[model samples]
Target chain A: AQRVTQPEKLLSVFKGAPVELKCNYSYSGSPELFWYVQYSRQRLQLLLRHISRESIKGFTADLNKGETSFHLKKPFAQEEDSAMYYCALRASGAGSYQLTFGKGTKLSVIP
Target chain B: DTAVSQTPKYLVTQMGNDKSIKCEQNLGHDTMYWYKQDSKKFLKIMFSYNNKELIINETVPNRFSPKSPDKAHLNLHINSLELGDSAVYFCASSPMVGGGGGDMDTQYFGPGTRLTVL
Candidate 1:
């Protein structure tokens, strides 16, 4: 079965510290990976995707096919960056259009 | 200009009651989806509709049904709601199937409807 695993449930860092949210997936075929962020009292929104290879809000994620991982990273964390982050995967499995999401990681950046 | 919107931002009702949550997307996307976030904050896919046709249905209970009258609207109705149904439901949309540009996989989520069952 295809699944998305976010190992960290909570991560805390200083304002200028580097931040990394680990994500691993289990799938036979190549799947699309995405990172969604949900700020306090706000709707969940797309932060970045593997294919895009673009950074959003100072966050970037690289897809490591060999490792079967798509980890989200940010060189410098800011207080405003604190939020709940979910790792999602889309495959040709039973749920085609729907994405399988991980439990999520709560990121807190202290000033 | 909400691309994807769901009615009843918050719904509090007693168990065994019947309720419906309406969802609509103005982005003209060909696909829509419903996701449930449990109290533990674990999110799961409930259903997906493409071009007003059901394409993906998760292991959700039969008491929950999704109806898509047109490509732009998809509604979820729960018959005899249970306490387990208490969670935040999110409505989302994407471009279409087999259309890959990275953006296709990026689903836009609504504000989410928090359903509380007592």
Candidate 2:
């Protein structure tokens, strides 16, 4: 079965500190990975995707096939960056349009 | 303008009652989906529709039904709602590229409907 694991329920870091939110996946075939974020009182939105390999909102995630991970990282954390982040995977096969999402990790940037 | 919207931003109802949540997308996407977020904030896909056709249905209970009257609308109806059904439901839509079953498209989500069953 394909699954996305976010491991950390909450991650706290001081402002200007580096931040890393761990994400791992279990899948046999190639998977399309994505990071979605939901800020307080804001709707959920796409942050980035492995296919695009683009950084968004100062956050970058590199797909590590060897480790089967796509951890989200930022050089410096900001108070405004605090939000709920979710790792999702879409398997490559028929009837695989649906995304399997992780439990999500809440990042709290302490001022 | 709202790209994707869901009706009844908050719903508080008694158990055993039936209710419906409606979703609409003006982005002209070919696919729409329903996701449930539990109290723990764990999100899971419940159903998906492509161009008014059912494409994916997860292990949701039969009491829950998803209806796509058209490509731009998808509605979820729950029968005899249980206390366990209390959660935030989100509606999302994505454009299908290359007609490849919308595998690699970016999904836009609505504000979400918080359902509270007592």
Candidate 3:
């Protein structure tokens, strides 16, 4: 069984400060990692995927195969960045439609 | 326009009561999913349907059943709800399930329906 772990349940960062949300996964085969963000009273939306390797809204994440982690990073946190961030993993090939998600990290950007 | 949407923004029912939640996707995607977010904010997939066919069924209890009338709709029905079943249910859809690349697994989610079992 694949499991995703988000070490920080709640993370506080001052506005303009760098923010890092840690995520680690336990899987045997290769897996696809994704970062999803849910704003206040908003639906969950895809932020970025490790496979895309594209930065969105000044946020980027790199897949670390060695550490079995994919941490979301932002150079400067903004008030709009305060939301619930969830790290998700999808197994490759068959039954890959199912996404196993982390408990999620609540990011609080203090002004 | 709303890409994915679920009916009954909030549901409050007593234990042992039966309830149903409906979901629809206007994105014309082929795959739809049902996920439950518990009180601790732990999101887990309960069911997945592609073209009205059952594909991914998690270890969820039999009390939870998903019905897909067509490619764009997937409804979830709970036979006997329990307090533990109180959670936010989200509906999502993706263009394709398995293949690789080109937004293969990029999912569009609904606003979610909060179910509270008293």
- Residue A16 alpha-carbon offset, candidate 1, angstroms: 0.9
Give the number of the best model, judged by DockQ: 3
Error of 1 at A67 (Å): 1.2
Fnat per model, in the order given? Answer: 0.76, 0.69, 0.82
Model 2 error, position A107 (Å): 0.2
lDDT of 2 by residue, B1-118 (tens): 8599999999999999999999999989999999999999999999999999888899999999999999999999999999999999999999962233233478899999999999
Leading candidate by lDDT: 3
Off by over 4 Å in 3: none
* Model 2 / residue B11 / CA error / Å: 0.5
Please report how far candidate 2 places residue B41 from its true position, in Å: 0.4
- Candidate 2 lDDT over residue span A1-111, tens digit each: 899999999999999999999999999998888999999978899999887888898999999999999999999999999999999988876667778899999999999
- Ranking of predictions according to lDDT: 3, 2, 1
The local distance difference test score of model 1 is: 0.91
- lDDT for each residue of candidate 1 in B1-118, tens digit (9 for 90 to 100): 8579999999999999999999999998999999999988898989999998998888999999999999999999999999999999999999886565477667989889999999
CA-lDDT, candidates in order: 0.91, 0.92, 0.94
DockQ, ranked from best to worst: 3, 1, 2
